[model samples]
Target chain A: MNKRENERNPVETPAHDAAHDALAEELEALRDLFQKELDRAKNAPDDAALPVKDGAPDAPPDADEGPVCACCGAPLTDADADAPYCEECLTQMRTRPVHAAAALFVLAAFLLAAVGLYLFSDSAAQWRQLFSAQRAVQEHRLLDAADRYGDCFLMNADRDSVSLTGIKAYADLCRSLGDVDLAALLVDARFPGPLLKLPWNARYRALLKLQAQFAATEQVAIDIFGAYDDYTDAAVYEDVDAQLCALRTDDTYAPVAVEYIRYLLMKAAGKPAALQMQQLEQMEAVDDGCYTGYYLAAMIELAGETGGPDAARTYFQTAIERNGQDQNAYDAFVRVLRRQPAPDTAAIFSVAQAAQANAPARGKPVWLRLFAVSDLLRGDDAQALREMQLYMTACYEQQLSLTMEEWNLYALCAAAAGDEDACAQIETALGSAQLKLSPVIGRVRAGTWTAAEALRKDGGDIA
Target chain B: MNGIDRVIRVLTAPGVWIRSFWVHLLCRIWAVPVTETRLFQNKATFGHLQHMAPPTVGAAFAIGFVPALLNRLLALLLFLSSLLGLFLFRMTGWVALSANTLAFWFAFSLYVNTYPPAEHARRMQTMLRGQGTRAQKILLAPGTFCCAVGSFLERRGVTFLLACAGLAALVLWQGALFAAIARWLPNLEG
Candidate 1:
């Protein structure tokens, strides 16, 4: 039958449908046998449910020498085993434990972070809470605000400086609440202990700056060196001194500098006399006419204040030497000299000489000679004659001319010498000069008319 | 009164005559080039007589060290002063600095004989072994501070010496401490 079937295969090749049918029948028979065997094996389970002498099962029903399920330690290598996870442990391994654990950890971290965020969200929440706590004390709620800040320090990054600022705010609030001691305590608490063991310059500066900020305007002077109980920092004293000195030295502050310098010295050095010494030194050092005359006067005044007659005389004498012709300095110097316990006379002579030496060239350079003449007129006849002789020499030898006032002095000198013609000549010049003088000048020239009276007559002091 | 009589009264005033005389004298002194100040000037030299000249380093040192050494010698004469105390004497730098400058140092040594910074400890030695005209680091010793004597000769002279000394000492101490720490924490080397 196989030989004839084999021979018929050629015909099957020739007809594809018949050959396909034959092959399908063979596959069906094999499938039927396989299904029967699988059914038998499935029905004949539970034979190896063995117990040991210890009354425990020797092995699991599906145990075999192979890799087991990681979750239940069940042998899972078999291709066709009922309940592949050994029936009892099938539900355990399929779930996602690693992923779930990760999710749980992340959730826990999120909750912690959220809690932190809520605790220290912003100053707004703290502000609200404090505002609600209305009390007699002004902003007594600041204590609570401080407490909130302290809580934030434990959780937040960048805490140190923030905490310090909060502490300062608390201190300010306490001060506003009329709790000065508590405010002081707040400052103490806020100071960084590790960094500041000795007296801290920063703290001192802060205190001074604060004083400058809050002091009552009426209670404090605008000057840098004004008296204040809290102006204790050495650095502050130095800074203020420097600032005031800078202002005094500045050309812009020059017109008012004299007054300010006096005030500054009186406040800083606590001695009005120091003003004189400083002014004298500055005058000697300065090259410009920036308050030169003012400085001389200041020195005189300082000497007067300190009752240092000798010092006053010396300063005046020096000023006279520099610019004796400048009536302002001479007058002020004379005033100081009068204030002395004992006035210096020689200084007047030297000042006169200095003035003569420094006088402007050409016509009647006699301001210094006049100072000498006045000194001579004050008492010393010999000195007066000597000054007059010197003046005459300079006038004749240098071809210099004398104005009317200078000629008056010459006339007086001639009268002393019994020279009638010179006196007459001076008198004629004086008369002519007087006649030619303007109304204002004529009024000033009249011995009876004061400058103020002349100014009143003119209706203004303008030239 | 007559002008001559008035002039006589001015002449007789107590300070006036003397001041005027002094002014004339000052003027005379000022007129002489020999008496003129040579400070910050080029005309000054070893041979010439000058005025108000900048102090030479040797002269400054001599002036500073003489009085200081005298004071120290006096201390030695009185009692066997602590060598350290002698070095820290207040008047040790008085010819160059201020009086009462070493009160703090003396007090500190007496009460807390704690180890001073290395540079502070080395100050006297540096002073004794000075170089030629090294610039002053500090101008004046404070009431209580440890600064090198050499620094007092230099410009920008206040507290700079002490600070520099302190910094050097701190660096040395830190280096030593770091070495010890390195040995202790071997793992940190990595």
Candidate 2:
């Protein structure tokens, strides 16, 4: 088999040897030619003389060659034989005296034209109307302001920035006057069918439709939504609450009722936590899918404030059982657990495990981070380090950045796990400016520090 | 550079080149002698002009505004005429559409090239800080500031992108407006 293979692929056949010999001869010829050229170049004179054609020396042109331009070597026309430079060159060299007067006249003409065009422009009219509307509002001439604003909108309803500004101003004026019908009319006229087709205008169109719906019903709902800008006024909240209560039982208005309740909870000051919790529960009862995880989180918070951490934990546990997919419930549970005088690490770990199991692809990093934190709190440094690595890998997969606090936690875990290389890598990645817990990392590695103490020193909350 | 960078450079070259030509022309008219002119891959350069006197803010403003105002007027005319022909006249066919497209591209190129170069802006700034009268300064402040800012933004191609966005928005607005008018005209006749 070896003999047959060698016969099939001979290393040095006669044809190959012949081709090699031919290549070597060609290379030798080229080398000889190159050497000759090199010798000729070396033997050449300092200012190498031009090679003569047919062994003839250079000679001057006959006078019959005719005159040429002195500046450019182009043949001069007989009509301009005395001229030294070519026509083109002459024109280039010729400098016309500054036409100062003509230039100033032209400048004046352009400036006047610009000013004239601007003064009579549609944009100018729009600007004037906008200014008048603003001045009218300042002077308390609501009627004039509305008219001017309407004119501005009609003139430029297709202009996003200008039309939006005018519409917003008109809406504000109408709302201040408690004229829902007029506000609805303003939005409808400004945002016609074609304008509403634009993607950016969809929200405005929805708002207009919502206002129309509410206007068809009790105008009080519109008033409650639009007129309660002053949060400090007890009278405003009382009025809003009264209107919301009246609409609470109507299924058509339940979403509005829920929104106003959430708004009041967020904006209303000095309201008792128990009352807030009561309102939240009422909102949830009538929510009709309008209830978000945020409301549950708020309820948990209020429960913790009014009924202590145990109550909050119960509420969070109930929320998780009701909707395990709700990340907010897990967050609230972890928060409430961590706030205890002595946190139950086992419970925290279990909640984190449940959260990780239920988390969507986007939320996995957050849950993994929570798991790492729980392990760190449990004093299982190596386990925490492993969890942190997993968390970072998850974050990388999701293209999410680790917060400064998370970086600090990772460094702490690395130090406490006695992984010097990992600690050094973290320090290099974070830089000294961002690694606020650098001093504490060393102490934690020395077994004289804790993650909670490092967090405290770095002005980060343990929770 | 990468493909997108090369494409952008190619796209922006004409505007810069035209602006350089205008600058050189304006310098000559102002009695500054331009010794030579040279064109490059993306920009043009003119030989240094002999300044008889320090450039005044007013002169700088006029130099910047003349070509810019002319170009803006031409662009606006082209834009409005195209809109009218397409919507009101109901021009159809590839011939009309191609004409309108060419007009639109030309108008866009002219608009992009309207801003003065950075040298004019620097001259304006120096004169504004040094020797201009308060009334003169006040009168010229808004125009000069806009020129300076436009110059800066143009170099980074931000102005070109903004102009493109504005044109897109304008086309959409005009389309919507014409559609609404067409829909309403029939109802009113009925």
Instruction: Give fnat for candidates 1, 2 and onward, in order.
Output: 0.00, 0.01
Tens-digit lDDT track of model 1 for A1-463: 2221211122111123443677899999999998997777777756633324456456544334666543366665453132223333322222212223323423433343343233234332332222222121122223333344334333333433233333444454444333434455545545455433445325523432333332322122365445444443556655655665555444433323434453444445454456546645654463133334445666665765575656666766665554334444554554454334444556555554544444344212354455544543355434554666677787788776655444544444444445556556656766776622234433434445433233224321211
Top candidate by lDDT: 2
lDDT of each: 0.38, 0.59
Per-residue CA lDDT of model 2 for A1-463, tens digit only, reads 2222211222221223445778999999999998998888779995563354565555544577888866578998865565554556545533533334334433433443343343235344664565566655554445556667777777665553243445656776665444555666776765445555788666556556556554443455556668757655787677666666666566455354445454563446558878778777766674433234437777786787688778898888767655555566776666666656577888888888887665545468768767876877787778888988988898889788867666767888788778889988887887755544456667777778666555435433332
**TM-score value, chain A, candidate 2:** 0.38
The candidate scoring highest on TM-score is: 2
Predicted structure with the largest DockQ when compared to the true one: 2
Which residue pairs collide, candidate 2?
A: none
- Across all candidates, the chain A TM-score values are 0.25, 0.38
Which segments of candidate 2 are over 4 A away from where they belong? A1-120, A139-141, A150-164, A192-203, A215-251, A254-463, B1-18, B24-190
Give candidate 1 misplaced runs (Cα > 4 Å): A1-289, A294-311, A317-347, A350-386, A392-412, A415-420, A435-463, B1-190
Deviation in Å, model 2, residue A9 alpha carbon:
70
